[model samples]
Target: MTTLFISDLHLSPNTQDITACFVQFMRNEAIHADALYVLGDLFEFWIGDEDRSEFALLIKNEFKTLVASGVPCFFTQGNRDFLVGQRFAKYTGVQLLGDETVIDIYGRKAVVLHGDTLCTQDTQYLEFRAKVHQPWLQWVFNKIPMFIKKKIVAKVQSGIRDEKEMKSLDIMDVTPSEVIRVMEAHQVDLMIHGHTHRPDVHTFEINNHPMTRIVLGDWYQQGSVLVVNDSNYDLQTRPFFNQSI
Candidate 1:
């Protein structure tokens, strides 16, 4: 069996390029895969069910297409798109996954996550995360009007950018110790995730053997995807139609 993983698309109403690419990906690449896992941030931001934008609906339809094709797909909450819930999942025919989920990918036990919780340094953001992800918060957010939600998204994005600018890159990224801790907790060597938008393979020693952390890149400058088959896993970065080097 083959499995595909992608995340951090940051999809929203205005990001036509990313939307186009994602639609193409689902129609072309995802159709044949045995399974698909969306780590998180598939949308730029999700306000709630009461105010889901047309873009979200479109993407949800795209996902439903994939699901109707008989391939299993799962979605985990990303920081931006954390508002995704049971309603959205049912509409898209996707199985909603928790923060950290362990599954067997082609024979190897792999741990998958959205990866933000591993960023142990951002204490303030962690607190916000806890609050926003609660069931009640989601219910309230969905009750707000679309215009109000858009304004909130703008405000939050501005604050998030400012916060990222103040924090060092190392601080925003996942900590090595945290990764090891999660690995130990999950009892898995191969972990795949996305959050920081840094695409690279991190190799470390575990039990006197080499372990790997595969980070999935966000779909902004280019398209990044990880494909795993029965034999091995491959990370491929593809340039968008008009993207330049």
Candidate 2:
């Protein structure tokens, strides 16, 4: 059996084409997988569990079906959807994992995370992350009225869009030193994460042992997936709407 990993779908109601692709993926590829790990950013934005959009409901129902089909599902919080709490977990039957969680896969140990924390060089965004990730702040945000919450989220998303335009590409990506440091601490042979939206399989050596880092891509123009079994690991992609890479 193969285990699957994906992230950065960034699904939203407006992106019906991508949503259809995701639905097809769940119904086809995922139904037969041994397990599925969503690194994070499954949705474009997730307001607390108390509030959900029509598309969000659709996605949740799909997850429910996927889990019922016998494939275990796991999720971690992302920069965009950190408010995925207990209610969402119950609705989809997905096991919520911490930002950095390690698990044994098929025989080898691997570390998985949403991958934003590695971008330590982005000082401003790091500061913002620290503030929003505080328990007190998250609780307060959740307590706000749904309408107010939407406005706040929209504003923040807009601000992020503008901010990204001003930042250099390197600053927005992971810091290599941080990646090695975190991997060393975990003592893992493989690391899987998605946040940079740059999909690739990278090889490195840590303590004289071979290590691999698999970066998952965003589901903007295409669908990206990593498949792993007892013997081999493969990265694959398909056109989202048939244009090109």
Displacement of the residue 182 alpha carbon in candidate 1, Å: 0.8
lDDT of 1: 0.86
* Per-residue lDDT of 4 in model 1: 94
Please report the TM-score between candidate 2 and the true structure.
0.96
Per-model root-mean-square deviation over C-alphas: 2.4, 2.4
Off by over 4 Å in 1: 242-245
> lDDT of all the models against the reference?
0.86, 0.90
TM-score of 1: 0.94
RMSD of 1: 2.4
lDDT of 2: 0.90
On residues 153-206, what C-alpha lDDT tens digit does candidate 1 reach at each position? 899999998988899888888988899999989989899999998998888898
Cα lDDT of model 2 by residue, 66-178, tens digit: 99989999999999889998999998999999989999899999999999999999999989988999999999998899999989999999999999999999998999899
